[model samples]
Target: MSKRMNSGASQQFVIIGSGQAGGWAARTLREGGFEGRIVIVGEESHPPYERPPLSKAVLTAQKPAESCYLWSKEKLGELNIDAVQGNRATAIHRDRREVELADGSRVPYDRLLIATGARPRRLNCPGADLPGVHYLRTIEDSERIRGSLSKGGRLLVVGGGWIGLEVAASAVSMGVPVTLVEATDRLCGRSLPESLGRFFMDLHLRHGVDIQLNANLTRLEGNGRVERAVFGNGEAIEIATAVVGIGVVPNTELAADCGLPLENGIVVNESACTADPCIFAAGDVASQPSSWLNGRVRFESWKNAQDHGVLAASAMLGGDALTRDIPWFWSDQYDVNFQLLGVPSVGNQVYQKGDTSSGRFTQYFVQANRLTAVAAVNSPRDLRDAKRSMQNKSQFDTTGLVPVLTL
Candidate 1:
């Protein structure tokens, strides 16, 4: 077992970034019988909340912003957590064991957690900083985009990643016309294979969304707000509101400045412990070892945020780490529930089952007769079984895996 914090002493557990990971870590510390002074610092004024709904329910105005909050003020108070809101962590003074904030405050910690989540990669083009070009990372951002969609006009969505697709779907659901621009030829190029990308393409295309592939956006041309977008292909389209969902840049400045190992993100062990024994990192800001990947990887999924937070807290309290599961993530686009379990690569042989015409099927990726990854469209049960197959690393069984479609 790892050495626990000295609870007998006036232990001060300071958590930086009150996002999913930080909030859960604070609660875990309290729940794990650590009677310590816990403080959770967040740049946002709101308490810890889930961001998944921002592109889905919240964007479509199906749910209120408060519904995404993981903890209410009353709940935070009940946990005895000193919630410091609306303060950016400027620097980490490792020698002094303190973190300096933008407000000229230094908070000390016996154990520190760096959960500083990532920020949206702003669109870089002419008139990019115009008023109408928005990025969705917070509830406030989502609400603003929702307002824009409600006003009724063509919404220009840039990037073909999950964020852009979700935003486009939400707008379509809101009965707003959407024209999606992708620099690449397909959607979610990094995560999805060509076949899966086609699935998404068909999904959006069927929904009456104008998808422009290999269409590089040159610039935004407008008077006040963004009124039009120019493409490298010498085509321009007038738009009412614009949303950029290119990607996110992980907030690794604090970790890098403080001298914690940084790669794509703050390097940490499976237990979420950093190189420095006094500190740990988790969530989107953490790049930790993954058995599934056979290497270290940084995940930007909601599952990673919550699980890593709990793991970090357990490690802090000298408790056994939680069971690591296969990295799984799901997306709700239009009316289809798309999910993927395990990391899919290009070389894997895909054996697809079920009918895509019905809009419910599972695609299995196998290499060397072993299940490597699985993608499902509205087939949660098969996806659940796929998780078990992945956990066992079982050889492919064609008994029930009869391929109706092979990719």
Candidate 2:
């Protein structure tokens, strides 16, 4: 209804998934002066909200669920955007240029953006569907896990990834004992380097967390809820509550059903355009070619969600946002603020500017004398300093009274 266009025709933009990507896309469209009918379909009850805090702040009771909100319902109305909450998009009728909803209504769209995001990967073992088995992806999930922690029982965290480590840290902050198990030999094998995993292991161990490596959780046992965990080695641990932080699976069934290409996620170009020119994809559900990583990747991070959503919307508005910026990710656990930038590979030469024993250091991943990636723990300033080397083919400046480790 807000007409900024000079054309005689009206264009409608519809976005699926009312999460970070969807919300930002809606805002970016209005900001770009796309005077058209914008409709956002959300499966959740709340408007688009941040999820990074759900593991740490919300789980530890440091912040309320309201703190995660990005935009309120009234804000969407102010932008003249129709945000349909508590409803899901059932199908996309591409032939009709319409999206069929669960409520049996079809919304016609001139162009569509699918930011469906992803769902937590569930375990296939027995007793996984029990009431006490929790997954942290939403505000309600965080609150439910927090409630379980407050009940005064030992919490078993499966998978030693970011989510698992954060949940363990949150439990420790609340005086709840935690036992973390990782199927691999080290923690965060997929996201972090092997050397960095040792630092995280030591950090959790210092906080009295029972961490088990090269461990596999075979099944959960309880009367009506999760009470015990059975490992692969026939060892069992008494756990009152369980939090599974394995990973996430992209929601690509919708795109797949509509006959779109899928490779790990919805395949998109650098401009976030899919196989169909009229439809685009972004955020966790989109597998786009990354200029930073030099490969097609589906990044599930807050940085990617915000940046990619903006890029998609910009491209939709006839603007050029055909780029994947350098990957940036951060996590907060207990007193640590760990940040990771760029991709870390085994071939990169690892270097550190500060002692790991001090619990604050910056690690650089160098390739051919050029810094390609950086990982910092509690050293935001040092991390920012290392970023310049990522562009220049120069050695890291480790001058003056500092400990440097080259591995």
Candidate number achieving the greatest TM-score relative to the actual structure: 1
> How do all models score by TM-score?
0.97, 0.94
Q: How many clashes does each candidate structure show, in the order listed?
A: 0, 0
Best by lDDT: 1
Worst 10 residues of 2 by lDDT: 1-10
Angstrom error of the Cα, residue 173, model 1: value is: 1.0
CA RMSD for every model? 1.6, 2.8
Residue-wise C-alpha lDDT for candidate 1, range 1-407, written one tens digit per residue: 45665363487889998888998888988888889799999999899999999999988888999998888889888888898999999999888899999999999987889999899998888989887889999999999998887877899999999999999998988899999999988899989888789889999999999999998898998898888999887889999899998889999999998889998999998788999988999999999999888898999999889989999998888766678888888999878999988898657778888877789988998878888889999999998887887888777785666553433
- lDDT, candidate 1, at 227: 89
- Those runs of model 2 whose alpha carbons end farther than 4 Å from true positions after fitting are 1-9, 391-407
